[model samples]
Target: MPRYDYRCRACGTNFEVSRPMSEASAPASCPDGHDDTVKLLSTVAVTGAARGGAPAPPPAGGGGCCGGGCCG
Candidate 1:
């Protein structure tokens, strides 16, 4: 449960909350009942896979730049 993005500086409300993580710095109230909220610093765009799958094979290079085989 981790989703927090609040911005309510008295009247500029913008909210999104999915609590947890120790309240994430507890203190959020902005449904037009401003509590002087400000905790909007969110940027999460994670998409991938990693779990003993296939991604660990690039460590012995010698051709300059990855295509390593002797530059021309």
Candidate 2:
């Protein structure tokens, strides 16, 4: 189950609700029993690079110091 964040306008309290994706848009009440609530926008963060794809080759003409002949 996914958790949804909500805020109660009547009591100015924030809460979370766990429900299915189908009910994502459904109305939720705050813990304070306030029905005047609104769902808060959530942000997702992606960490680490994706795997399985071949690594990209170094830039042409060797742009880096080690590849551009700077260290050589």
Tell me the TM-score of each prediction against the true structure.
Answer: 0.28, 0.64
Per-residue accuracy of model 2 over 1-72 as CA lDDT, tens digit each: 999999999989989999999999999978878899999999987655347666566677776866677865
Candidate 1: worst-modelled 10 consecutive residues by lDDT: 55-64
Backbone clash tally (model 1): 2
Candidate 1 ranges with C-alpha deviation above 4 Å: 11-16, 20-42, 47-49, 53-72
Give the TM-score comparing model 2 with the true structure, all chains together: 0.64
Among these predictions, the greatest TM-score belongs to 2
lDDT of 1: 0.81
Error of 2 at 40 (Å): 0.6
RMSD of 2: 7.7
lDDT of 1 by residue, 1-72 (tens): 998999998788799889999989998898778788899889989755556776545557643565677564
- Model 1: lDDT of residue 60: 73
lDDT of each: 0.81, 0.86
Q: Which has the greatest lDDT? A: 2
After superposition, which runs of candidate 2 have C-alpha atoms over 4 Å from their true positions? 48-72
